[model samples]
Target: MIPAPFDYARAGSVEEAISLLGSDPDAKVLAGGHSLLPAMRLRIARPSMLVDIGRIADLSYVREDGDRIAIGALTRHHDVANAEVLQQLCPIVAHAAGQIGDPQVRHMGTIGGSVAHGDPAGDLPSVLLALDAGFVAQGPTGTRTVAATGFFTSLFETALAPDEVLTEIRVPKATAGWSFMKFQRRAQDWAVVGVSAVRANGGVHVGLTNMGLTPLRAVGVEEAVGGGADPASAAARADEGTAPPDDAFGSAEYRRQLVKVLVRRALEEALP
Candidate 1:
């Protein structure tokens, strides 16, 4: 289907993009155009203008910041998957980034775009949640940081305001013992159920994908593990708080069962 007619403006910097978005209430920011373009083509999104930020070169980088790894918003999945910094410090993130879609999508899709899109089925969000990442956003007022725990609000919803542009993502550098498990119908397809597990501080952090309105932490499973339950026992609670969709992939009950098995496998692999 043809996308609705819209004016296009390229932003030379983050400030310019924010100004363009603020000036036009209906303007959508375009990064890699992986998420927004598809929505626009389907008529699910009708914007009067598209503020392109692809030319903002400063927003495409990966560096170490004190105790965290700073990733710019425009960094592509292909870069993230091969980044030496991410691979050495956070292999789970690199592995998940490499597995998103096929080569074409990974080469064009940006991590910031994936996280900001707030799609429950997106692999990166669940991995970011497990890594306890933080997002930086810039708007007319200035920049602010939002934790992954509160970044996702609902289905296709996020904490970012209308004129806010996500600038960077910050993830801790000390995480280890990580595992990312994805269950899909075919190669390059969205996951039927996915689980991300990583050791943080002293306990395990677990995030579930496609099991709720947003990427969700498996708190019930975490609690069980904290209480000294075995991997199988902790995984039994993987579905305790989720409300998965019943659609073409699988029923809610089927997802519930899948989560248990996947969580168990993930825990067995992630735990020391």
Candidate 2:
């Protein structure tokens, strides 16, 4: 299938991108275009205009900002995978980013684009949720911070407004002892069940991807573990609040069970 014909424009700055999007309701921002372009090619999505932000080179960096790690929106997965700073500061995100699509996709997909897409199956959303990451967005109104948990709303939906552009991601640097595990039918496929666990502030945070309508935090499981529940017992609550969809790979019941198993395994891995 061929994508619908659309006007194209390169945005030189964040302000320019925001203004472009605000000028047209049917415009879409292009980062690496890994996820958006495929949908466009299939005609599953059609836009009147495309505001290409790939040319805005400033939106691609990883820096230490006080107690937080600041990630520019256009940072590629390959960059994250190979960064010595990420290796020492947040190994889980680096490791998970490496496990994203194949090498080509990693080189082309950006962290901001993946998380901003708000796919329940994407790895970064769940990991960022577990790490309590914050997103920074700029719009005509102003810039504001959105916590990761509040950023993901539904399937392919996000907190980003039509005229807003996500500029950066902020995650606490104090997180340690993190583990990311995804169970897929094959390599380079979306996870049937994925878990991101990290130790923070004397408690545990766990996030579930592909186990619900949105990337969800396993609040019950976290509380159980923090309350002294054994790994098996805590993991039993992994599916307490999920609504997984049934598809070619697995059913809701099957996914719930997988969540339990994987959460238990991940908890053991992170806590050990």
> Which candidate tops lDDT?
1
Off by over 4 Å in 2: none
lDDT of 1 at 136: 98
Off by over 4 Å in 1: none
Could you give candidate 2's per-residue lDDT for residues 127-166 as a string of tens digits? Answer: 9999999999999989999989789987899999988999
Error of 1 at 142 (Å): 1.0
- Candidate 2, residue 138: how far the Cα is off, in Å: 0.7
Worst 10 residues of 2 by lDDT: 170-179
Which pairs of residues collide in candidate 1? none
